[model samples]
Target: MNANDNIKIDDLKKPYFVWFEENWVHDDVLHHHQKGQLVYVESGFQYITIDEKIYLLPQNHAVWIPPNAVHKTNSHSEKIKLMIMFADIRTKNSFYHKINVFSVPPVLKEMIKYAEKWSKQMTPDHDENLFLKALFNELPRFVEHSLTLHISLPKDQRLTKVIEHLHHHYRDEIKMDDLSDTALLSFRTLERIFKKETGLTLSKYQQMLRIIKSLELLSAGHLTISETAYEVGYKSVQAYTRSFLSVMQFRPTDFIKTIQ
Candidate 1:
């Protein structure tokens, strides 16, 4: 499939369909569709932006986008694999109505891979539809286990400058007063506006950014654990590991083992 595939997807008559695309490196522009989408990262990671937040979809994980939700996709690597399922809005499953990133359970993961054989529009009352229905039926339960690897960007110019600075200087010793100076606001005002716009305090937002970037570096296998820690701004490996565990609910070593 090419970049125009999305434009053609809505015209297909199926209630749902699956698309298997490998070696994906393109960055999709802002767009939306009438159907909900569940994108599973079959191999490498990808990032998707929606509602002022950027979500990291790592291997063995999936991100769900509700119908007509404006979003875009990006992948830095050319070796990434993606299996996407687009379902009609009429399914009326409330669980399909939100955007979230979650670990794809083994059963559903296999089911999606198995669906690659029918990688095109699927008709209703057909055997494939039954299988597709079963696959989607399993989504809601897994959503409860969604990951917190998304960073909320801010719309306010002051907060945006602060966020951009943090993105570039996250490894440095950052002070709230410095951030306030960057934003041209008082510390209290900066904190208040930052939290109001991004739903996260300044420090928490930077921490989330570090973790998200660390996942990219670690998953690429280009950096050692200690290197990744320091690269993401932790002064020591222990602190980085603790933060990784706190956010990911698993040690960095364990995570490394999985991607290995």
Candidate 2:
């Protein structure tokens, strides 16, 4: 489950103070942004809608949303996050793509927080601008999914059956015995294989899948919070929000607005 995607910004050109807020039980409509955005999830979970594609990103990861892409967003719970909006696209850029999530070094985090704070200060000092420029120029080119979970299941063809089942039935409650029967493997073996291939336990992976699908539905503006939660196999909207916050660290509403 996720929160709404509605971002309210102060000014892109001016420096600003952004607070991470929390809200549960929300569903957002399809929307896009007019400026480039840099987002970091500090505490909870969030889903980003990119051109109708859903990306499930958890804590300590970031996603770049470009201008003019209609999308929706949700969260399992309210989360803490940082959002930086840019007005111009510089020629000297590192990553060619928009969305990115990787393990951030301590220096980078400090730099981002500092820049954001300094920007909001809005001093007329050339030294400050120069320092900001240097920081941006020196920002590292990081690989995405550097620490992301990657799980690979058993090679048994029957495992394919299990995967197929999950792909279609993520909306429904999942039981180990049911999954085991479908995969034609013992529960014990399937458990091991599931972790081996996916890098997440069965329930954990299911949550990830739900997060992935939530972004899709959010981008399409097709469902309500209650609907989204139930559709994504969540038993309660509050439960969904809690999960979302664990991944995105912000309420779905704020996330949607920022993306929008």
Candidate 3:
């Protein structure tokens, strides 16, 4: 049984709930609940959608979903492992009010792993409840290290066409001319409106996508640094390493080691 089994987490009277599962790729329909959610990516990666934007949850990372936030999730990996927690939203902690993706520090990682033993509804004042409370309280200290790599979906049809093309051909050497042709807009108009819609230049946005896809490739351990770089449109390993470091604050080799 898993979190989506007979038990409805939102209907519980307890202050917290925990669930652990390791399975194949899973997808959830769009939904929302009254309790805040914390999902730790034990293996593989997840794509979480909120407010029409997509956030990538890489291995060794966790994502916080605020209460009442409309969202959906999908995982494309062959193996999927995750630890999920839901908490009462009455703690008055502003930190729980927004979506955040963060690297799980060693301390918190162990804490979350330890929590798997009690995968149940936890009531206030219980020993399990106290531990869960402490874990939740410790999250704020790591907020400063959160990642902001969400891909915002554009409202315009032209921009949407361009973004869809980018998603499919990110491994190619994408040029403004190609994008302008895809969007049916002039290069200058496309650049201006793309930035206005997504808050990122077209090239910057594509770079973010490349880095995000690199995380999955690196996690799967099926390719070398150079091959992964090429798979994501980086012609040189140095350029790929620099882009990865700029976004993830670590080199590809270091990332592989950390997650291992």
Candidate 4:
């Protein structure tokens, strides 16, 4: 799909499903749809911003976006394969109104591939409607494997500056005093407001950012564990490994093996 192309939500007929294998580098403008969307990432990663909360969808995971939720997407990966399934608002199940990330089951993955092929070979009709209904039935199963990593942005301009700085300089050693100065807040105030807004202390939030970025690097398979460690602000490979294991529940090598 063209980066400039915006899918028209109003033009979509009820009980319709369409799929796209996006292989582009673009930052989508903020938009919302009347139909809920299921986005499966076959390879690489995509960052989605919904209602000011950033959710990172890594490979082999899918995100279910509720209808009428404003969101935007940005991808830096050279190869991005995404299959998007649209569900009518009326047919949206209990997953509506919340964004969910889950491990895509093998059955549902095959169903998405089959639906993509079926939609191309046949026009809309009763059989397609039946297929759409079957697809909707399978959606609720995804919630069982939901991954919750709520990375929300602060509304305050001062905190926003700090967050932006962290993203850009996550590779370097970030000090609380420095961040406090950047936000024009004292250390105590910064800690209080950051935890209040994001439910994570400044240090924990920065660690989360490093782990998130490490996933992208490790999944890409271009960097060694030691390189990735220092690249993401960790002083030692062991520390990075422990942090990765604590957050991702797996070793870096194990994660690399899975992607391979």
lDDT-based ranking: 3, 1, 4, 2
List candidate 1 segments past 4 Å from native.
1-7, 25-27, 121-125, 257-260
Which 10 consecutive residues of model 1 have the lowest summed lDDT? 1-10
**lDDT, residue 155, candidate 2:** 52
Q: Which one wins by lDDT: 1 or 3? A: 3
**Candidate 4 TM-score versus the reference:** 0.87
Model 1 clash pairs are: none
Instruction: Report the lDDT of model 2 for residue 1.
Output: 19
- lDDT for model 3, please: 0.82
Please write out the lDDT profile of model 3 over residues 1-260, one tens digit for every residue. Answer: 24356667778888888988876344467888788889998888778888778898878889999999988885557777889888877767778898898878888899999999877644544877899888888888966567787888899887878988888887777776778988888999999999988888888888889998988888777888899999898879999999999987878887776567
Per-model C-alpha lDDT, please? 0.80, 0.56, 0.82, 0.77
RMSD of 3: 2.4
Residues 1-260, candidate 4: write the lDDT tens digits: 23655545457655666666657445577888877888888788878888888888877778888888888886557798878877776743466668898767777777777776643322467777788787877688656656676578888776988899888987777777888888888999998998888888888888889988887887676888899899898999999999988877767886665454
Instruction: For candidate 1, write residues 1-260 as lDDT tens digits.
Output: 24635436677788887888876645477878888888988788888888768998877778899999988875555588888888876666677787888877777777888888877644454877888888777778766567767877778877777888988987778886888888889999999999998888888888888899998888777899999999999999999999999888988887776554
The candidate that achieves the highest TM-score relative to the unseen native structure: 3
TM-score between model 3 and native: 0.90
Expressed as tens digits, the lDDT of each residue in 91-183 for candidate 2 is: 445452354545455666666666554433433445555655555444445442342322233454656888777768877887867788877
